[model samples]
Target: MILSVALLVPWATGAVLVALDGRRRAVGWLAVAVLAATFALLAVLTAQVLAGGSQEVVTGGWPPGVGIVLHADMLGVVFALLSVLVLLAATTHEVLAGIEERVFPGLVLLLAGGLTGLFLTGDVFNFYVFFELAMTASYVLTAYGGGRRQLRAAMVFTAVNLLGSFIFLLSVAGTYRVTGTLAMLDVGERMAVVDPNAALLIATGFFIAFSVKLGLFPFHFWLPTVYAGSSPAVAAILSGAVANIGAYGLLRFGPTMFPAQLRLVGAAIVVLGAVSLIYGAVLAVARGDVAESLAYSAIGQVGYVLVALGVGGPVGLTAAVVYSVVNALNKTLLFLAAGIRGPLVAGAFAVGALSVAGVPPAAGFVGKLEMFRAGIVVGSVPLIVLLTLGSGLSLVYMFQMYQRAFWRAPAPAGPASPLPLRLLTTAVALLVLAAGVWPEPLLAASGRAAEGLLPGAAG
Candidate 1:
């Protein structure tokens, strides 16, 4: 029941918000309260899971293998918590910035709800449903502001995502036809016995779908334009919450269903990731807009996760999990800070830029270090070197953007009122960074989540 509430709260809240007049300030508060409550519930659920309580709820009284199952295992909880935190921050920031257009808050809540469902679902078909939910809400939000650039970006984003969804559906159908089960755990157990060629074809479908979503090298055409065109809050959600689904899918499906194929194909992924790291960084350095640069920076950051996944050891897997959480927070902060418009905005951007550059004591630094260590243990020396070069490039581009945005004199000073909401949001982002710097709690939580997948390593 609690798990169901966690998945449904956002939609429920969105319904209530929709019924209210959009012109009133109270609607925004209502939306915020709903998200805050949802966050509280997730925190409590995470605590219970950490205490070794099982967090599975079966719907319609169906058996575990056949039922719609929602499980808050470590992986699910880590992402759920992240989605809640980012959504809350974005919502509050929007409310404060007086950008509380009626549909905006509701759409964000819907997006969060979809993500919650995605994380909790234990069935493959259900995963697709939730994926569509999240993607659809995001599409609407992308074009919500009604600018020409946003509209164009949203169209590209929609077409690509819809095609990915179709591929995902075909994969799901193929898997079900081959194994006679839609439950992910059961499918994994049965996959080893399926025809080798059939299995490979089905797995290929999943790979192509997730690759497009994650913006892997050849398929990443939509990322820069979307990030550059969307509002800061929307960009934060896409990079932080939405982008993670790709990595999660790889972790969930690849190891369980295609271990042999993964071993065979892993090197290709590693190579692509390495190329993305260099390609994205070099392009970022060549670009001038702060948001566009960060957009490219995300490409490199996500590539690190890909490299870790390709390594396929316990340490590498752990690094990937931790890196996802750390990178999500860091990216969210960087994107949000880029939206600041006052004299102090430059300082805010600098703090965030330095953090993303893997400055000491920050979350990015910890994640990067762990990943490098994992690469060494896995004998992926080239990956380790590429990651180092990537980090150095990140520092160069980020600081260059910082220097231009802040240290460069602003066109003659003009009268302007400070945005209180933006300031508050920046404060929240700073606090999030602080948590990352001293990330004992999040790391412990992540360790517990990683344990479910690697039971032997769950110390």
Candidate 2:
């Protein structure tokens, strides 16, 4: 019941709001109110899942394999919660900055609903359905400002991701053909007995699809232009929220359904992660534009999550989950702050910079610490060395951007960004700081999320 309501609120409201004039104050605030209500519902669902266990509802009350299932467990709810929070913050930021488009508010609501549904779904085909819903909204959102740059970014984003989607759809078809089931749990159970060669090929398809989404290495050429060209609010939403689909897809599909294939390719995963880490950080140092620099930085930041995931254990998975949460917050704050200039905005940017560098008194430190713990647990000397070097590079580039943007740069000749915008960025920065100061809740949630991937853990 809770799961149904959680999905219903944003989706229904979004449909109604699509025809409203989102540029008006009332309509924009109304959209924000609807999102807040949706967030509250998800909060309730999260509490219920945490206190009891996984909560599931099958449409039409049909048997498990027949009816589509909306499921809420620790892993799904946590990611869903984070995704909504990012959407809420980004939407509010745009409202404060003044929405430029008539449909901006409704589009955000639609994206929120899509992301929530994808995170909670149990059917692989339904996951793809919700995933496309989200992507479709994002494709339009990428062109929010209607500038030539924005339109080009949207074109590149749509073209490249469309390719990734086709590959993903084909992979889904292959999975169903091989296992004769689209239910994720049933697929996992059946995948073990199927031919390893077939399973490995399917796993590779999934890997390529998710990798393109995350903009990993060779597949990453379109990312910088899209993130750098979009408006700050949209960039925040894309990196902080939309990018989670790839990370979550990797976590959900890799270890959960294809453990044997994952084990076989673990080292390759780590090597690719290491290359992305170095390449993104080094390129970020050379970029002059703040948004472009941060775009490259995003590529580097996600590498940590991959490294932890490749290590593949309770500790490693926990590290991956924790880092993903931290990275989302960091990117959201930094991207939003990058567009603003005023008193205290630099302070907020500094906090984000420190967080990205994995310095103390910021949530990113907790994520980096978990990565170190994972490295130690795995007893991989090279991994530890790589982690150390990556952190160093992250700090160097972040400092360079901070100094150029906030410290050494001249005051803007135009009026400062609005007070509300600055305040909102500050609030997000404070949240990052609070997470670092009191990390027990985040750690516990991440631990529970990781457990969901373990064998014999409740589905």
Candidate 3:
């Protein structure tokens, strides 16, 4: 009952809100109130899961194989909570800044519902369905400002993601054909006995699809255009909330469903992660635009998650989850700050920049520390060196962008941002600081989430 209500609140509210003119302050606040309610419901659900166990429901009370299953374990719940928090922040930020389009608030609610559904789903086909629901909302949100640059970004994003979705659908079809099951756990168990060649091929398809969504190197060409060209709130939502789909998919599908394939490609994944790290950092340094630099920074930041994932153990998986959470917060703060200018805005941006550079007293430091631990646990000298060099490059690029954006004298500043906007941005930065000041909760949650995937090793 809790699971079903959690899912329904956002969808039902969003459906009604979409018909309203969201540019009206009342309608906007109504949407925010509904999202806040949804978040509270998810919080209740999370507490229940933590105190007891996974909460699951099969619609209509049918058998597991026949009914659609919604499962909430630590991993899925953590991601779901983090994603909605990001959405709440981003949506609130946009509303404070004044929503430009009539559809903005409603689309955000729809996207939130889609993301929550994707995270909680226990079935692969339903995962795809939720994935499309989220992507469709994002595609429209990308063009929220209705500017030429934004329209172009929407086109590129839609085209690339459409291809990725097509590939994902095909992979789902192949999984069903090979295993005769759409349930993720059943697919994982059955994949072991299926033809290795077919499994590997299907695994590769999933990998590519997720990689495209993640904007990983070699598949990252479309990312900068979209991130740089979109409105700040939209960019933040894309990087902070939407990008989780890729990371969550990788963590869920990799070691669990296709362990053999993951082991086979682990080395290659680490190498690609390294490439993305250095490539994005180097390119970020070369870009002059603040948004473009941060876009590239986003590309580099996810590299650490990949590196941890490729390391493939409880510690590594924990690092992946931790980094994913911190990265989302960091990007959300920076993107929102980038769009505003006033008292406390520069300081807020600086905190975000420090976090990105893995400076102590910022949440990113914890994530970086976890990555180093993962590398050391594996006794991989190259991985450690890569991490060290990546950290240094991250600092350099972040400093450059900060100096360029905030430190330089402005020609003539426009009107200062609203008080609520500044306060909201500062609040997010302080959350990052608070997490760094006391990381026990983040670490514990991440460890538990990792244990859910790997089952025994100390995270």
Judging by TM-score against the true structure, name the best candidate.
2
Question: Over the stretch 1-459, how does candidate 1's per-residue lDDT look in tens digits?
Answer: 778888788988876676666436677767778888888888888888778755778877898776678877778877888878888877776666556356888888888888988988888988998899899888888886788988998999999989988999999999999999987777877888999899989998998898788787777899999988988778888888898788788877887567766777888878877887788889899898888898888887788777877787677777778888887887777777666655556556666676677776566777887778888897767777888898899999998888766667464342232566547546755665676578788667655655566523221
Tens digits of per-residue lDDT, candidate 3, 227-296, equal 9999989999999999999999999999778988888989899999889988999999889898999999
Q: Residue 178 lDDT in model 3?
A: 99
Regions of model 2 farther than 4 Å from truth: 413-417
Give lDDT tens digits, candidate 2, residues 231-337. 99999999999999989999999988999899999999989988998899999999988889999999998888888889998999999999999999999999998
At residue 118, give the lDDT of candidate 3. Answer: 94
Worst 10 residues of 2 by lDDT: 408-417
The alpha-carbon deviation from the true structure for residue 131 of candidate 1, after best TM-score superposition, in angstroms, is: 1.0
Model 1 gets an lDDT of: 0.78
Top lDDT hit: 2
Q: lDDT score of model 2?
A: 0.91
TM-score of 3: 0.97
Q: TM per model?
A: 0.94, 0.98, 0.97
Against the reference, the lDDT scores of all candidates come to 0.78, 0.91, 0.90
lDDT of 3: 0.90
What residue pairs clash in candidate 3, if any at all? none
**Ranked candidates (TM-score, high to low):** 2, 3, 1
